[model samples]
Target: MKIGEVSGHASVPVETIRYYEKIGLLLKPDRDASDYRVYGNAHLNRLLFIKRCRNLDMTQDEIRELIRLSENPEADCHEVDALLARHLIHVRDRLSELANLETALQQLQQACSKTGTVEQCGIMGGLSSELGGLSDKDTDQRNHVPGTHKPGSH
Candidate 1:
């Protein structure tokens, strides 16, 4: 099939396919007599694998490593386990960060429950204090520090 067909079937953009080829992630397809690229089942399968990895939030480098491992079926899977573990840690950390952000936003929302001028708004005051270079530790304990939260708990 052509690039467009492959992209549609794989649910990935054509540019992304081109980039994968450019970065040696995907092998370049053969060209037909008319100069159109000729892709095959191998390309389709590889593209789908790449798409699935991306959907799982795996980085490009990680995908590359996985592809390498796949090419060497005799290689031990310990490294693959390690890579997945690392990615899980990152995902857990991000989930914790997002939860903390939600809590902070909730607190900020409550700051000015009653409509008032800018001088009387607590949310604005907190934001301004942050922008003014006040240390996160120096701020009220109720205020959430963006990156200080632990994983798996709000």
Candidate 2:
């Protein structure tokens, strides 16, 4: 099969496959007489596994470790378990941070609920606060803060 065939069957983009190869995640495929890259079942299988791991939000390093462990069929899975537990903890911490962000946004919304013109808009006032860098005209700080609440549709 060709690289395109592997990409289509594995649901990974051609660019991503090339990047994996460059990053040493995927081995470079053999070339044919026409110099076109030729992939086999092993490449397809590996690409699919990597896609599944990415879908699960596993980092590249974690995926590499998993691949190394997979090569040792007789090895115990304790390291895999530990890695998953650590990922779970990171997820939980992010959730907590999001909750705090939600509360802050709610408070900001409440502060701006009063009817006012554009000149007296509460939401704008909160965004243009003294600490919001509006005085310095630095709007790049707008989305720099993580876990922000997007006040959309309401």
Candidate 3:
């Protein structure tokens, strides 16, 4: 099949498939007589596996490692177990962080319950205090750090 055919069957975008090839996650497909990319069942299966791994929020490095381990069918499952355990811990940490973020947002929302001018807006005052590095001591410092980016950065 052609690249587009495989992409449609696998539900992965063509650009992503090309990127996977570039990143060494997916092998480059063979070309036809017209130099068009040709894909096969192996590519489709691999693409599906990669998509599943991505859906699990696994890092590219982790997916790569799993793929490497997958090549050796006789290898012990301990390494895979360890990797999953680590990922679970990371997921739990992110959940906790998200919960804290929600709480912080709730507190910020409650700062100004009534409608008013910007000058009298408590929410704006809290945000301004945060930007000025004068945030309340009770605020969650971990999630409140302002992110910085260079101009025109994605």
Tens-place lDDT digits, model 3, residues 13-130: 9999999999999999999999999999999999999999999877778889899999999999999998888777766766676787688788889999688798899888888886
Query: Scored by CA lDDT, what does every candidate get?
Result: 0.82, 0.76, 0.81
What lDDT is reached at residue 67 by model 3?
95
Off by over 4 Å in 3: 132-154
Using lDDT as the measure, the top candidate is: 1
Give each model a TM-score. 0.78, 0.75, 0.83
Per-model clash counts, in order, read 0, 0, 0
lDDT of predicted model 3 = 0.81
- What lDDT does model 2 reach? 0.76
Please report how far candidate 1 places residue 43 from its true position, in Å.
Answer: 1.1
Top model by TM-score, which number? 3
Give the RMSD in angstroms, all C-alphas superposed, for model 3.
Answer: 6.3
> Candidate 3 versus the native: TM-score?
0.83
TM-score, candidate number 1: 0.78
User: What TM-score quantifies how close candidate 2 is to the native fold?
Assistant: 0.75
